[model samples]
Target: MHTLIASPFLDDHLLLRPGSTQGLRIGERRFKELAAANSPCPPWLVDAVGRRWPDLQLAGRRVDEVVLVRQASPFGYGRASYELNLGCNYDCEHCYLALKKFDGLPWPDRKRLLHVMRDAGVLWLQLTGGEPLIDKLFPDVYRLAYELGMMISVSSNGSRLPNRSILDLLTTLRPYRLTISVYGATAESYDSLTRRPGSFAKFQRGLLAAHEAGLPLNLNLIVTQHNAHEHDAMIDMADRLGLPHHVFSNMSPTIYGGAESLPAQSREYLRKRKPFTGCNAGHTFFHVDPHGQASICKVGRDPQIPLLAEGVDGLARLRSIADKLLLRQGGCTGCGLQGTCGTCMPLVTLYRKANAPLASYCQHGPDRRDQQRR
Candidate 1:
């Protein structure tokens, strides 16, 4: 009797007897041959049957039934984001964390956490960071996840890919995707945003190197007032490289509840009209900080629950929170500007507590008010 195990990530089905590690990949013809006993049995198969079904030779003994079990996948939620580390090489001015200290989980604990996630049916993993590639354990962690049958995506700064060793490792692992942040199209504009002279050249070189290596790569254009003017050029650069790019203009306040680090124009940009629909954070997606603290998302990093301690049960608790959080509350519920409001409850709860001006995140800007006047 043979059991079949199927993998979503693999095209082949593995055929095995009960309690046997040795297996064969079989399609329709091989499966029928095995069932009908029409083909000669291989030595390995004979040995496996003998060892695993030793009791079957006894009188009145019958072959055990072959059981097939399909791999479990996450229910509705198929993706997860993990902040591999909080340490970064670049110190961008609009950084929400403001270059805070790196406090990632230890290597052993991180491995265990991945196991837990796999068991919970999370097959798609996003490994992000202050810059995931900068961490020394990145390669080992990535390999482990890949071996565990997870589709891995990386968020990086593109600074390290220029190195031959790193590029080779990336090419070998073949991550599902790599999203690199592009600050600017030129060295001066890019380095100025990163606050590291010559870093822009390193990024460009790394991007080109990755391209040459044939690794799947995408660009994330982080637009701040300082480099907003270079948006067109940045897109053109990605086009020239034949890579897809996404532009993000909204900037969050500092993680420490301060807006002091954001550029003036970035601060103003957040006040403009925006769609105010609630996010899908705790439901289909969640964020795990470097310290293994799980939250709804990066922007809504409050009420963090310890992920390793609670595991999937903690995710359930977060789902409850998300169910109750999908609406504008308090002053936002009845406000006439609700349609144009960009700020959500979580953002308001975090940033407004510091008494930072609400106007910075409100939709009642001068243009909106003037439109109302007319």
Candidate 2:
């Protein structure tokens, strides 16, 4: 049976059924109105949220199931997350990767990575980092990913998009999606968060170039104190560019890594919902550290659970480990939003280091009583 769930950020609903995952259609205007009127209960306004699903309902309340599930492997993608790199260039106020000490990936690790991805039967390989473009082997990495028959995607900051060489390379490789993080529509707001002047203009130029290059583009906006109010503007920019807008609710104080030495953000006094239940990490995706050890998403990086080694049975081994984690609660014990929450590994580790009792940042801390009461 398929189930429809509300996405934390997007206005449209995400249909999660047995062996399939898809996003339902809902226009921007309708999305905004529903989100605003719905307020705190993010899932409620969008409809299908909170509604129990049967084991076999199709379409209608169930919605469309475009993604096909592999019967032999079953999970969305046979192997969950295939982490490409860990380096990024931007110094945003809410950079979890940097804080977690997820330094960018190195070129020397290519052959090893190729072996891992191939053995895992990974359906989707997400190349992430401080900024994957910074990796000298960017082009080769894309080619290698494609050669392995893995659908490739990259998350970039767009600052380096001005490089024609990289743009040209992207044209041929044609990544499945190029998700660019746009801090703001204007120079002031954009540069303020990134702390890089003229970044906004660079991002705009990059958008145009990507479109010209025929690369699929998606815009991601991190909702922070400096730019949350500009949600409408961000949406407008996406509309103008004809791209999907991804708005992440800023929830952390600082990133992980020794950078714990850095300062924290002024958190918006919003109601923190109950931590989601269910072991989404292994059940959904597996986060890999640069050393080739697999953990439940990134949080496993902190606990240091080696689900798989960089060898023959790597993928299947990882799945078995994930299955173990899912069958029995590994870390997440009790809290709000248990089964319905998503977390970034770096942020969760950072919070855990700061407050040993609470390691998972996404599942950590107490909910704001006032916000919940309302």
Best by lDDT: 1
Candidate 2 ranges with C-alpha deviation above 4 Å: 1-85, 99-108, 253-280, 303-310, 314-352, 355-374
Question: What tens-digit string does per-residue lDDT give for candidate 2 at 268-361?
Answer: 5222444434455654456666556666665455344343343534444454555554432334444344454454334444555555334224
lDDT of each: 0.70, 0.55
Write one digit per residue (lDDT tens) for candidate 1, span 265-366. Answer: 454335364677766778777778888887877767767888788876677778877655656776566566676677777777656654566666675756
Model 2 scores a C-alpha lDDT of 0.55
Provide C-alpha RMSD values for all models, in order.
10.0, 13.2
How many clashing residue pairs are found in candidate 1? 0
- TM-score against native, each model: 0.75, 0.64
